[model samples]
Structures are given as C-alpha cells and as structure tokens.
Target: MFTRMNGIVCLTMALLLGCVASIATADEALDKAFEALKTYKWGQDRATLGAIDAAVVASHKDDAAKKDLEAKLVAVLKSDAPQAAKDFVCRKLSLIGSAASVPALAALLPDEKLSHMGRYALERMPCDEAVAAMRDGMGKVKGLVKVGVINSLGVRRDAASTAALVGLLEDSDPQIAGAAAAALGAIGSPDAAKALGAYQAKAPKELKLAAADAYLACAERLLADGKANEAKMIYMTLAKPDQPKHVRLAATRGLLAAAGQK
Candidate 1:
C-alpha cells in the first residue's frame, strides 16, 4: 500500500509523462497563452489561472508553438526576471512541459542561476535520469546540493536510495541530517523508520523532529503488521512533551490516529 505522498508523487510523474504530445498552432491561442503566463506572474495569480491553463492546453496541439514556448520557459528560467518568475518556471515544468524539456531543466541545475530553484526543477523532472543524476552527484556536493538529492529521492519515492538517505541521518551537517530524516519520513518505510529510531537518542532538534515523524509513520505500518509493542513505544516517546515541540505534536497526533485504527 502506497502512502498518500507516494501516491501523489507517482501520479505527478505519471500525469506529466502522459501529457507529452505534439501541439498544434493558432496565433490567437498561442498569444493568449503567453500573455496569460506573463500576466499571472507565471501561474501564481488566480485571476489569470484560466489563461495559463489555456496556454498549456494549446501548446499540446501546436508543435512549433510548443518548441517556442519551451524555449521561452527555459529563457525565463535563465533570465534576470523576478525570483517569482524563475521559481514558477522551475516548479511548474511538469505542469506545462514534456519530458523532452527534462534535459534542459537538468542542465540548469549547474548554471548558478538559482541554486535552490535548480534543485526544485531537478526534483520535478519526469524521468529516472534525474534520480541517477542526483545520486551520482551526491558524493561530489555538500550542504544544499546534498539536501536537494535527499528531497528529490523522497519526492520520487525511490526506495533504492534509502540506504544513502539513512547514512546521511548522521552526517556532520545537521541540515543534511534533518533533510535525510525528513526524506525518510516522506518515504515512510519500515526500514527507514527503524533507521531513524536507532538515531533518535542523539539526533538534534530538527533531526529529532523528522526522525520522530518517520518513526511514528513506520510504527503505524508495523502496527498494521502486528508489531504492537514496538509501535506503542514509538508513540509513547512522541506523546511526551519533553520531546521537541514538533516531535511532541507529531507524536501526540500519531498516537491519537493510531488508537483509532483497527
């Protein structure tokens, strides 16, 4: 059984992949769509939402228009536009473009254009190549780059990266550790839960919070598998106020949720 996040992540990739097809051309429609993107601030404005949607839909039917739009999007990604525009392009790639744009998007990751947004774009890529790139690049990078890989793997639900994620839970950098713990929580696997639990005693506040979330999630699955005692202890720890506020809050809610479960 997939978790809610896992289902949404898979559905996102599937939907993006499914949307890849040739677009037809019509000057009025293409112009309207581009205007929508510009006016809506790249889909952030509710008023221009319809126009943005129209543009994306129109692009699917116009090959020349689609290529032109993708080029524009990439340029938007590269341009000195407001941070909001760059962010919107990076975050909405899957929503408006095909997998073919993935290579171009991936190329942006190293451009020093916007490090954080580049990571966001890479995470949104609709292909396994993105995961491979993150994994292969992990050892060569540190700090935010490593954090990006942790996030991308979680969003992808790439279980194969679980061991690497677990290893990062103890990384010298607390942010990296925290990201690893959060990724594990998002992955929500029993193995990840156990890995998090094993480090709970020494993890920092943020890492502890993340570990607690993962532990509670994992405990739920374990409880579902008849590991009652094990699950109870994790819930018990989480419910204690002595824990970090986030951890305590998560644990208390987890306990309540677990109690009502059959």
Candidate 2:
C-alpha cells in the first residue's frame, strides 16, 4: 500500500509534472507520460510521469478530464505491455483510480507475478467496488496471495471482513494467524476488539504480541471515537501484570487518555 510519504512524493512529482505538461500538446503529453511509465526510471522518466500524475489528479473532479485519463490508463492495461510496464500503471492507478479501473486491477489479483501490486492498487482505490473485489478475492487465492488479500483488507480497514478475519485467527499457519490478528487491530472496532480478546488464549504464543499490539490500537481508536467505556475495557485487560511490561505501560497511558473523553 502507498504510505503517506509515497502520497507526498506522488503529489510533489505530480506538481512538477503539471509544469512539464503545460509545454507539451495534449497528444504529446500523454504519449510522453505513457512512455515514462514503461521506463520505470527515477530522476529521469519520473519527470514525465510526474506531469502525467498531476494531470490525472487535477482532472479527477472534472468528469471529462477524469474519463480521458481513465481511458488512456485502460488502454495501457489492454495493451500487451510487459509486466514491469503494467506494474508502473498500477502504481499510478493507486493514486487516482476509481470503480472504472476495478476490472483491470481485479484481473491482476490472481496473477502470481502481479497480485501484490494488484492488491496495492485496489487497497487505495476509494470505492465500495474495490473493497468488494478484494473481499471476494480472499477465497479464490491461497497461501501468501490470500495473505496479501487479508493484509489489503486490513489496510483498507474493511469492517465487513471482521468476521472473515476472526475466522482466520484459527488458521494453523502462524503467519496467517498473526496477519489476521494485526488486521483486526487495524480495524479497531468494538466487535473486532472483542474477537481479538477472545482469540487471546487460543492464539499461539507467537501470536500474543501482535494481539496485544492490536488490542492497544483498537482501544485507542475506540477512545478517540467517543467510545471511552469500550476502550477502557481493553485498557483494563491489557493493564494486567501478565501482559508484557511495554504493553502494560501503553494500556495505562490509554486508560489515562480515555479518562479525559466526553
């Protein structure tokens, strides 16, 4: 998934790209940007893409501008581009993708070489359809691919996956179980917190630390959202001496924070 830092870099690059595109014709600008996506070169082709990226974002609010860019992107996906070339487009889509891009992005989910980046785009695409696509994908893939899907859903904070994630807490693969635990924490809902709490004794010893961390995260979110009492329950549980010293400290601090809520 793109981090805040990546978003910052993309925005900065887009601004510079905006300046570059102003000097080029419409056809010249897009062709140059498409070429840059294939180069995957930094400091060099990034300038071309930066201009293209800026154009996409600036046009998002205007239906015609958005559709034009979206069409160009779809054309790139439909082309027989190399995996590297396609991957480059996926990164751009993550920044400005909508439901229109879902089918193209969704196609990459089952591909071993591309599933990671595929999820990367789908995770950031702000639409109910994007969420549904990933959620549906969870059952169709397995092992690490499924793990990737789980992680993306977590990053998305898809509360709808709470039950599915809770079910995954029982998987024999420790990593899968651990990922599920961490994802539940990312969700940080009252029910998610309860599930994490319930999974405590059943989760492997290797999984407890993640559970603890997630517990704290869920509690903190609940506290912040005016659900202090619910948050306090988690805080009290983790504040127990049996929890690791650091977790106990965090729980204590959370308790104090919760006390100040309305």
Candidate 3:
C-alpha cells in the first residue's frame, strides 16, 4: 500500500510539472510573437503571428490566459506599431477582449486608418463601456469614420444612442442622414419608431424612401417584441395611398402580422 501511494504521488507531481512546462513554453512563444509584431507589415510572413493566434485559441477555456492575452494585445494598440500589427491585434481582441480593453480600443476610434479595426473589436465587447466609446467617438470623427461608428452603435442595438441618432437624421450629408435612419431602424425602440415617423414628412426627396423603409423595419421589430399596437400604428401610416405601392404592400403585410393573422 505504501509503494502504491508513493507511485500515485509521483504521477501527480509529473502531471503538474508537465502543465507548468507547457505554460512556460506558451509564454516564451508569446514573447517572441510580440517582438515580431512591432515591425510587422502587410506582406510580411504571417508565421510570426501564429504563436499569438495559437495562444488565443488556447485561451478559450482558460480565463486567466485570455485576460493575459487581452492585456498584451491592448499594450500593442497603445504602441506605435505598424497598422498591420495593430489591425491583427484588434481582430484578436474582438474575440476575447473584456471591458479592460475598452479604453485602448476607444482611443483608436478617431484614427482614419485604425477606426474600423477599433470598432471591429469594440462591437463584439458586449459591454456598456464599448457602446459608450463608440458614442463618444461619434463627436470626434467625421465623414466615413463617423458613419462607421454610427453603424456600430446600431449594430449594438443601443437604445441610448437614439436621441443622438435622431439629431443625425438631419445631417447635411445625405449618407450620414441615411445611415442614421438605418441605424435607428435597426435599434427599433419606441423612440426610434417615433423619430422615424416624424422624419417622414421632412425627409429629403433623396432620403424619403429610405426613411420609410427604416420606419417599416422599426415596426417589424416592435411587432416581434409584442408591441402590436405600436407596430399597427406604423403599418397604417405606411399603408396610406400616398406611399409607394411596394411600401404599401409591405405595410399591409405588417398589418396582417400585427393582427396575428395567418
């Protein structure tokens, strides 16, 4: 019995040592990858990043490793690394990043070259901080950068951005206005529905049809959420003869669905 117990103890110690050695090897690999990342460029050998990618995959079930990887990625974002390196890091962060990564990612939102990658990470963060970062980014960016942030906010279904988005509906740039309308529709809140309804009359000729479609989208979401009366109100408005035949047809279908009909 003494010999058997001694053997079991030896096996346990061997397993522990093996795990420790594996962890040490992974750490060394990550160190080498990060060193290579500093000078990484678009057409460079991607094998340099393979270690980091492997670390990310291994992090899935290991929260400590995930957080460690995220911290390292965030550090890279704060560095002066090439855009290719930053872009790769942001992509990895999108998968395992937590709120801790919010500030670093947010800092890149106004950078024309990096904004989209930053948003790519923030969009999947699933935290209020990420949403706030995008919202704050809206005021600092312009043109297409601003549009990307607006789109990310909508993708998040952030009702908090509805008021800001409503204001954007009147932006002088039709693309901005159109994107805001679509985002509000994607949000599909009561406030979004109301705002879209009011915008219909004032919508520029170029945007009139887009606004109507957004309103329809809002109504569809409302109906799905058990807000049938509100949905019906929007459908009835779009069903008016003055609206286009296609809009009317969609509204008619919405009306039927709202009424719980087959």
Index of the highest-lDDT prediction: 3
lDDT of each residue in 1-262, candidate 2, tens digit only: 9999999999999988997786566658767777766545434545667656777778866988777777778667767776776777788788878899888888888888889988878998889999899988887877888888989998999899999999999999887788888889899898999998898767778888888988888887788778999999999999999889999999999999898787
Q: For model 1, how many clashes?
A: 6
All candidates' lDDT scores? 0.67, 0.83, 0.93
C-alpha TM-scores of all predictions: 0.59, 0.79, 0.92
TM-score of model 3 vs. true structure: 0.92
Winner of 1 and 2 under TM-score: 2
* 151: Cα error in model 2, Å: 2.0
Cα lDDT tens digits, model 3, 108-181, are 99899999999999999888999998998888889999999999998998898999999999899988999899
lDDT string for model 1 (7-54, tens) is: 999999887766652223344555665555553453375444344445
**Per-candidate RMSD, Å:** 14.3, 11.7, 2.5
Candidate ranking under TM-score, highest first, comes to 3, 2, 1
lDDT value for candidate 3? 0.93
